[model samples]
Target: MKYSLLILTLLLTFSMANAQKIYSVDYENQADVKVFVVDYANQADLKVFKVKYQNQAGKNNGKWFFTKYANQAEKKIFFVKYQNQADLKIFFVDYKNQAGWQKNFKKSLLY
Candidate 1:
């Protein structure tokens, strides 16, 4: 029973490691992912929803929690002015259900 509990703890830790906890860095050089906000949903690689809590964040599925600290985030991103300079393109959606990948090929950038 003790060993099972330990395994569960380990599994949870590894699972949370990929949680969409994001930190926006001031500098592009400090970013793990360079992102661009697209004007239209069809132009985006991912349709994102901003979750209110860390627990509400998705597993690289576009539901992100913007962390107050960089250390708390799984991935740090910088917003680029142009789409050409971005590693990923995203469009913010009003509803949580609207959040998801439009083009999954760029999904590994967050992972």
Candidate 2:
């Protein structure tokens, strides 16, 4: 029973760490991740889909929910003017099914 409880706690912690509750910060220093929107999906590290509800957000799968307040967000991001300055390059996708990371190696950036 103790081992089961430990496993459950670890699972919950991992899920919460990958939550797509994002907040846009005004400055780069305030952000947990620096992002740049790419012109094309092929050029992107991740393809993002904006969700209307927080419950609809994905777990490191690129389905994002933009929180109104910074405190409400799981991850705070800053938009970089140039692609070179970004930690993650993303392209906004029209459909939720298309939202996902193209480069799995950079997945740790969100965590």
Tell me the spans in candidate 2 whose CA falls farther than 4 Å from its real position: 1-18
Residues 1-111, model 2: lDDT tens digits: 999999999987776665689999999999999999999999999999999877678888999999999998989999999999999999999999999999999999987
What TM-score fits each model? 0.85, 0.83
Tell me the tens digit of each residue's lDDT in model 1 across 1-111: 999999999988876775799999999999999999999999999999998877678898999999999998889999999889999999999999999999989999988
Q: Clashing residue pairs, candidate 1? A: none
Clash count for each candidate, listed in order shown? 0, 0
**Deviation in Å, model 1, residue 6 alpha carbon:** 8.0
Candidate 2 accuracy as TM-score? 0.83
Candidate 2: residue 59 Cα off by (Å): 0.7
- Candidate 1, residue 83: the lDDT equals 86
Global lDDT of model 2: 0.92
Q: What are the Cα lDDT values of the candidates?
A: 0.92, 0.92
In candidate 1, which residue ranges exceed 4 Å CA deviation? 1-18
